[model samples]
Target: MPASTREAVRTAVLADSDTRWKWGALTARRITPESVEPTGFVLRGRATPTARQLTETGVSDTAPREVTGAEFLREVRDAEARGEGYDVVVLALVGGAVRALLQGLADLGLARRPVIVTGYVGVVYEKLTDGLLLRHGADVVLANSRHDAERFRAVYEGVGASAEPVVEAALPFLGGAPHTPEAGRDTLVFAAQPSVPATRAERAYVLRRLVGHARLHPDREVLLKLRSKPGEHTTHLEEFPFQKLVRELDAPANFRLVYGHMGEVLDRTDLLVTVSSTAALEALHRRVPTAVLTDLGVREALGNHHFVGSGLLTSFDLLDRGLVPAPDETWLARQGVAADTPYEAAFDAARERVAALLALPALPPVTPYYTAETAPGYLPGVLARHRLDVTAPEPRESGLRRVVREAARGAYRQGVQRVAPVIRRLGEL
Candidate 1:
């Protein structure tokens, strides 16, 4: 298609944190045609990424504009009223936020609106029903795997809701050169999550085990690939950071905290280890030797249970003893990490579904499962948490007031990252 004649799909992605921003932006690019580019927006909140965190993802060349839920909704409504609105809007937010936005959009009652897209950033191990229902109203509720797609449809269908919007897709960021043994150094990377092993004790135990492994193998390079720095936030809260825990332990020179793009780190990695991070999928995609830690036990809380039949679950003791496990092909197929499937093809169904939606005369109002009429008791609280109300207009703030509010938000984030941790530590003493 010629540049002039081609339909330029104006895409917008709203994400809450660094990881979600990366996932949403990449997903927007993947689902759209090659000729179109996607714009990104970071939802201003506690989980908002720091400048460093955004830069480290390496997903976007430019920084995304940050907006509150009301601000974003107003922008979309005003744009549509002006006949210059986005063609696709990806909501990379938590379930409540997504639900709030759906209500907000429904309240707009526009003759035509953007095709809203939403999905899990990674593995859908917990809150499956609640999250899926909250995202029920999107034009396309993407499932990162065949496993997820089935589960999503079942939930909707069970509730007697339409499952037409559920689309099968793979994690957009899954790609890298197949792992090859390097001549000089062998690297082991433990992909860390923010809140998986939620307690301080569990996190400390994992850190000790990692340090012990590093001590046992002095020659091999070991890396703690953290999702975010101590002050910076990702998808989840980090009550206990590995960076903080490592300071208490005696780690060797070969084992250090390295932060950068995961793919770049995987390029030199001989083994990839994680409790239950989506990084395991990326590693398996690249044929990298990977392990899902069983040392912490195969518990749902830790999320390692998701890999139970995958053949990647093992303990640090086995890893120290030179045991390298290969993933089961059947399990990989179900997880959308099939060796034979091309990554490019993963978004075909989504693209086609989106194209058809775009071709329609007018799209209907966003109708989430939890509405004021259906779930009178539940819906209000969800909307209220994000400060969204379908019954009233969102309040507009003056420029000076906006500046002061942003400054206050910055201070609050600083306290959460820096001061609060210190206070907690002091309390412990």
Candidate 2:
């Protein structure tokens, strides 16, 4: 309530590295940790062993602290009692964890801490869960484009929340020095998503379409760029990974399975093809011609509603027939990528929001719940059942450590084989 007691927090979430870094730098100007916890980050959900999410974001594996739901409430209460309550809590959660975390906080009688909800995925407003969270829990929600901000405003009105919090912030990762464009190379990158081919049947259809497309355009290079390795558990619950499917294909020389970051992959991509994956947005940002294969449509599991109205939406059949479409200028204008807005202006817009948010008085305490109003339907059933009742993941060995451990085991097996005859003779004696 007082300027002396004002505090700010940014949850050190794995998926929110850009937001965390941007806000962390902005807040350092006005708020210092010694004065009043400038950036007090709390752990939210558990990470899968194969996820390696934290490592991917450059978040340290050390110093992760855990607290039960009730314990969390006590911490909030304790902070308030000691006159050190946080003024703002920045949230950039990737999944339903935000709702689960919010529900727990609400149950504990959430201290008047304003929550800022954000997302990195484009066309996420396609999911109603975000609208529900914005309406019920979040005081503010960041939008990457004026188009998305308007959509967020519509959702807020739909849920009877104020549109004032739906503010425009440039997509953080879209900015930076442009790499050498893959123009003239005629390279087609199939931004392989786990969602496009959710089942084996869908997988077969998409792969067949891609290979067919490549055959028609033999001069072009077709790369199946995977989001993760064969077994990594990403946000997409992939049943049949494309990495595994490549082995069965009667592959051409140009057909290759590439593993790496989307940014790195985009370095050489000329024409980007996808089943309405957000990678299209990256291709757009990079000024590459992208085509959204509406072959799957919005029905069943292959939902690509985000690419609606974007001029790039095409059919896999069209690609198979060797027809490439250009991105719509109107759609590009609507997206408001870094190219459209000056980098300094976009960066400043985000920083200004944080500066103004933290300057506000402590937020009114909230009564947390676990219904659709609190948690989005997108959350895991197990997580929904245990809202706020969560456990933090213990830090684990890095991928390198795991590889070293496996190598040592292999060496031991070879040594044991060499001594097998001697052990058998000793046992007889």
Number of the predicted model whose TM-score against the real structure is largest: 1
**Superposed model 1: Cα runs more than 4 Å off:** 1-6, 389-407, 418-429
Give the alpha-carbon lDDT of every model: 0.86, 0.56
What shift in Å separates residue 219 of candidate 2 from its native position after superposition? 3.5
Please list all clashing residue pairs in model 1, or write none if there are none: none
**Per-residue C-alpha lDDT of model 2 across residues 1-429, encoded as one tens digit per residue:** 433343434232222232233333233322222333233343322212122333343323442233334344455556766865544454444435555556555555544553444444455534554534533455546666777777767776775655665667655555434545544687889987665656666788888888877887889899988755543444545556676676788988878787655677788887899886767777787777788877767543555666667777788877777677876777776776524656446545555555565566665444323354444554457354545532444337699997896576445533443344347557979
Tens digits of lDDT, candidate 1, 1-429:
111223688788999999899999999998865426677789988998878889888998899988888778878877777866778899999999999888787777766677889998999999999999889899999999999999999999999889999999999999989888979878999999999888888999999988899999998899999878766778887878888888998788989998999999999899999999999999999999999998878998998889989999889999999898989999999999855778889899998888777777777667778877778999888887988543457667899999898788778877987788779889999
RMSD of each: 2.9, 10.0
lDDT of 1 at 27: 91
**TM-scores, all models, native as reference:** 0.93, 0.70
Worst 10 residues of 1 by lDDT: 1-10
